[model samples]
Target chain A: MVGPHHAIKWLVFALCLTIGSAHAADPEALDREIDQLKSDVAALSQTLFDIEESVLHPADTQVAVFLALKDKEGLELDSIELYLDGSPVSSHLYTDRERESLRQGGIQRLYIGNLPHGGHQLKAVLTARSANERFIRREVRHQFRKRPGESRIQMTLDASAPDYEPVVSFQEWK
Target chain B: MQGLNNRMTFKRWALAVLFSAAGVSAYAQTGHPELDRGLAQFALGAGNGALALRYTQNAETEQDYLLRAKALLKTGGQSEAVRLLDALIEGDYYRGEAAFLKSSLVSNDQEERRRLLQIAAQKGHGEVKQQASYQLAEMARTNGRPDTAGKILASMDTGYWAALGYMNIAADYGSRDLNPSRALISLRVAMAMAEEDPNKERGEALKAQLLVRAGLLAYESEDYDKAITFLEKVRLDSYSTPQGLYLHGLALTGKGKHRDAMQSWHRAKKYPLAFSGVAESWLGTGRGYDLTGYLGQAGEAFLSASATYESERVTLRKLADMVREKGAYAALLADAGETRAEWFLADSRMLTQPRSAYLLRFMENAGNQAAVHRVKELDSMLARMERQEHTLKVLTSVLDERLANSASDNKPALGHVRTEIESISARLIAARQNATPGSSSVETIRHLAQTLKDLETSTDRFDKRLHKRDQRLRVLHQKASDALEKLDHRKRKATDVLRKANAALDQKFLAYIDQESERMLVALERAEQQIAHLYEYLALQNLGGGSQ
Candidate 1:
């Protein structure tokens, strides 16, 4: 009969070899799985961010300020409250609501007289209260000027995100 | 036989003498045809043929009696004049004046009046002809035939006579129905005649006065241009009274040279309304200083303008407006009394909340009240304007809706669609069978469509350009960032290299400079020592030489 010690050593050697191979393979496989997971996580995070931006932002974050003088139509709107450097311009604001508030955004309609042929602007924060639970918010720094007659204002927004498309827009009476 | 015949002849002669005396007495006592008839009846009643014959002879000899009869008839003694005229016509004497005068006095009974006027016209005498025309005009007036009277008056040729007849005819029309043109023509002719001949038997001054009257009549008749010409003719520059100045200013203002008008007004302003101040102001001069736009001066002007007029008068509105337009602070402040305040408040109220006089119950009761009168008239005008505005809005909207609905409904042949397209041309052609005139619906639609197409094309082009620009900018930005990073790296390497080169060069050059400086110092020191020795030797030599 072969010697038991030799047999045991051989078996042990095999066991050691298998365990060593497993150990080597385990670390490599775990590293590869971790790398895959990191890529997937990055992709998922980007997708989530894009979805949130589209759903919540509703508008471009970087707004271009403009000055505009709408025809008499501008005056007929529900309220035209202009805030300049966080203060109300008396000429543009119907009336000051309170010290705490810069202007009364939802004041009654103003009867603005005929607008002389010229351009004007108001840098402002616009808040449109909705019939629903959500409040529409716009941080606008609009910069537009009027011409002699009827003219259209085309606004464009710039942003840094890769998937974000710069939005262009205009306003018209309904 | 001789005694009887002679006695009878004596009786006849005596009877004839007695009848002649009675006839003479009767003719002396009587006056006209009636007097002659009475004398004849007296002679006949006395049973004396010789007396009757004598009375007839006596009546024939009385020329003054016939003249008295003509005078009575000519003076519109209608019955007496007609009786005398008839009796005179029966006679073989000339009776033109009596026939004419009697015929001119016929009553309004058309047949009789025409017969009388015709007879008078037949005479061909100028005065008789005028009287005939006058009678005809009277008939016309009495018969409600003023237009006929005007026509007749217009046709008359002789200036003075025609003018006289026209004046009478115009009077028949009364002031309300008066044809001022006819009146003016007549007056002008009369005036010229009076001015030229002025019947110097009457007076030249009277003629001039007549001219003035004619000019005033023309001026009041709304013939402003003619008034100007006529008044200027009579105007004497030397005459400086309010009336003269007023007329002068009126003429100038009517001519519409406002500056000259203002000058006249200014000169005339020294006079009050009772003195002609109003006419001056209307010509637009001599208003208050307050009305002049000079703040300090306007106060005085406004005060004067206001003071010149009656305080309770409605004309104060014009003065108030003048002061307001002057924009003088003091003038406005001073003018804002209770009355002015009420006016302002009323105006403000009207401006803020428009009143519809038609809807107000008080309006019906306001027959003569000032505000009521004004509001009623103004409300009607405003209502008409509002109606026009509403109509325009409706028309424009209808056109718009027609166009929109047409485009959506795909009805290409719709009248409104055609109208919409036609509107762009602004040529208000009458609408075709189905089209409304002045509606350019078709043209409008075509223009809008073209504009929308252009917008689409432009938007696409703009989008492409912007996208390209954005991409180019981003790329350029990235390249700049990379170039900056490379430059930073190159700067670091150059700085390190430069620092090492500078350190080395500094050490070498500094050491060399120091060494050169040290060598010079040492050489100088040695040379100095050598020089000192030489000098000492020389000194010794010199001393030895000096000692020698």
Candidate 2:
């Protein structure tokens, strides 16, 4: 004998009670949902970053320079300055790992940048201390044609010859 | 110019020998004053360029060509030097000096150099002949022709040069070949020849240097007693370099004389040689105490040494910067009060490709706090599920057992029997209440009472069935308890592995910090020493006009 208004009220009360019960069944559900949302956002952000990097630095125009030592015992490298086409590009003071790598006949990637295809002059200025405690500064220059692809330059300090002074040389990667 | 002077001096000496052989006593009257001045300048190791220029302009003798050749070599004119040396080699005078110089210059052509050295050895005079013979022997030895080397050495005349040659050979034998026994024999021969040399003071000085070399060789060869014997004979003031002191310390340490070793190391640290940093590092770390424990002091000494060398200092500084940066990040993570995921997110944002992999691994494994908590939650949930499953299984088995007992015993089902019993009890109570003392319904009441008693017996039978079911359920619960116990043990083992993995990661991080910092410190110290040495070298050059 309930009126339509009273029946609608009862229906609304029932719906609210059911919804409250469902929510109360698992209190940590909201927290888990929030964590999932955060994880998704982070993953999306990382993907975007990767895409940006790939779009910004493509392969063809990239140029890289590597430095190495033939014999580390005879010379203690202090610092090195690199110049491309008469403009300074990179200057680095050596780190222990870098020095150790050189001593162990390993090479370090010293500089990376982009360059247009053409001839370029690269210069490396190296400062080092000799085994006899003498400070020595050496400058080496090389002219290379960076064709329509990536260019790689390798600068090496060779101290293998016993009777001669240490020599620095440059080579281009094909 | 020095070459010219040396050849001129050799010519004068040869002339004197010839005059004496001819029984001429007035040879000094023929001596040239200009030649004497050149000889004096050559002896002082000065003005060789001017002397060579003068000789080139005059061009009077074979010695002048030799001097010009030497000057060309000094001035980086190697091709011109070689031509002049070839001319001298074909000439009559200064052939040995020219051949020796050519041998040094044409090192790539070993066979020709050896042949030239042979000619010099056969025809050269005084020290020149002795040096040529020694070099030929060295060449033979290096070519793996030991017999030829021995023969060459045997043919050499005993003199100051011969003594020096023996010492040089001994040094090669001991250091390069690791033949200490053979080196000792050569050293003994050199000592005997040195004692017999005409220049007593010079011979003794050379012998002392030889003794120091022998001591070090013996130390290297691990002949401690022999090393001590040789080292004791070394003259400290003239021959005690930092290396010598360091070696002496090692020898003392080998002999279990720690106090003496410490004393030697202390003295070694006072010198500004290359080994001084090593000595300081050793002393700073309590002479081989655990380096990990004394990292700060050890790093300081190492960095100090690194600073002495320009290249090494730069390297050390870079290493230090990297370590400092990484260490600060690690410290931040360690002190962070936030959840592991939050920390990881912040830390990973600053990481590059390969480094970011560490965070990914931590996030995946139970190595991080968040991951561990997640694992623990899963483990707890699994345990609860297992408990509920066990309870359900026990309940199902009890119900099945009750049904089987009811069927085998030909008894009524438990639910039907209980319902009947309740109905009978209610009827008996109603009938008793309705029956009066003289009423006709007394018989009906008595029948109801009998039905109630029978129902009570049926209820007791149901109780027995229920007791058997309870016993079976108890057995199943016991089995479940045993299974849960095994599960708990396995969980504990897995947790232990996780803990160990976390500990290993921490240890790796700590070790990276410690080792890189130590290396940076040592390199810094070495660079500082090298800079100081460079400065000292420059100052000395300014004061003395050239490197000593």
Candidate 3:
């Protein structure tokens, strides 16, 4: 093992290299980083494959979707705010005011009759945490419908793809 | 550090043997030595199939074969897995686990389904145990061992196993069209267990199936109320299964709700073959239209039904007796015929009542027929005697009523009235005796007439005093009312005393008539005796001895 003095020297060298090269690195260093990324991707693929491989066919674990509705309107009105994990999946603009009830606390709730499938919102409240960082408190509010035969129901919230990965893993009971 | 070194050494030894099994050709397939080594490592991790195939086609590497055998199941080689498990069992290495897994994958037969279930019960994980038990129950039912299925299901106590078991039993009962009570009991037990097991998915489906079946059984038993209740429960739960809807339709039809029944039947068009063809034929024959629509539509429906019914020879034969009776009032008849067995079972006693009475009267008047026939070659003595006896009974009852009225009338002589009634009754009894010598009813009539004659004499004498007493009471009431206006005068005092005297005198006259009471008591006793005699005569007629 290297002594603490050697580790400190290496750390300083890494910092100096980062500050000097910044956006322009040597080809050798670039190649090393590319190789490292390739290895990381392959490792990730293997880990996923291994986890999937562990389960026997006719698996004990099943993925299920609970399609719940609070108050659904059918074929009468269109467009309602939707919430997923307590955060709004849409811009805070009200499209159907007759259905959207506004309370005194600046909180908006939609009385949705039905949702169209695919590319919809999970109506939620966006609370500002600070000037730079905003915190989203989300609730699973509505599931929109799509024209029959759509494959996936995409919840289009400001949160990035990494935030809603858990839903894809579930297999609906039907 | 020593342990890590040892583990690495073991892994390296394993990897080297596996890599060398690929032979020189596979080695040359990868250009660089480092890349070849990586490929070899990936191949080792590629699972038993890669190792075994590499070993078989290239080098005869025993290490690759050994590892291949250990992980054979990972490659979907179930038979190979079983073989390896057999070898492991012989070697006593993971014997139980290997044997259990091998049994599970290696068999699809029902017997194997049962055996695996038993093994699961003995040594399986929680979910495995539950699933295996359910599978075994289904296998048992398929193999015609419902009792075995029931016992296994009972032992399960909860979850999908119990629900499936109950559902199977219900189906078995439905198939045989017998032992519905037993089937219902099993289904209810299953439903109860399922309700307690919150995570069980089969609960709702099984409950719906059981309810539909129970409703049908009740319908068959003619318990319309219960059938409606169970079937309505299924519908309220939004159970739209073909059989459930069909039975709901049947129950509605039973309750005479033909409009609703038609709606249900229309929905049941999805399962054409599920119902008996007779029901389909009934529907086709305009039964629904007859109930709810224009007569023109009904005729069309019937015509279509007849065509369809005739097309299927087997169904035609089964339903020939049913649909041939169709008309405006045919539904009532069909309903009656269906419940005929129930009616016979229920009113067997009441049906015997009038049957015995008619038979008795016939035999009493026809008992001498054989004797007369023996005397004449061509004759109906019984018919002649029956006619005579019937004529006499009619004459006797008419004359008796007439004589009774005349006796009660103050203008008619009591002796003449009595004479007329007695002579008519005597003639009727003599006629009955001549028809059937030993008939008890003839003697009973004679005794009744004598008692009535005695009652008539006493009634006439009592009526004389009663009429006089009534007249006196009416006069005394008038006197009492008149004396109220003259209460202070001597005339009022005199009238009051006279009214009291008149009331006492009327009471004395009524008390003197003991003969009327004695005659009524005697007449009533005779009437009771005549009723008893009639019952005995009826009994004799039923047994075919009244003619004698």
Best by TM-score: 2
lDDT of 2 by residue, B84-198 (tens): 6776776677788888888876668889988889878876887778888988887887787766877777788876666776776786777667568888888988878777777
How many clashes show up per model? 28, 32, 24
* C-alpha local distance difference test of each model: 0.39, 0.57, 0.43
Per-model TM values vs. the true structure: 0.26, 0.34, 0.33
Candidate 3 matches the true fold with a TM-score of: 0.33
Residue-level lDDT for B338 in candidate 2: 27
Ranking by lDDT: 2, 3, 1
- Score candidate 2 by DockQ: 0.01
- Compared with the true structure, model 1 gives a TM-score of 0.26
Name the regions of candidate 1 deviating beyond 4 angstroms: A1-174, B1-66, B70-79, B89-96, B103-111, B141-157, B166-225, B235-248, B255-548
Tens digits of lDDT, candidate 3, A80-153: 34354454434443332322221101111122123322233334332312212434343434433222221223
Those runs of model 2 whose alpha carbons end farther than 4 Å from true positions after fitting are A1-174, B1-45, B48-51, B71-84, B157-179, B191-209, B220-223, B238-240, B276-548
The chain A TM-scores for the candidates, taken one by one, are 0.25, 0.66, 0.22
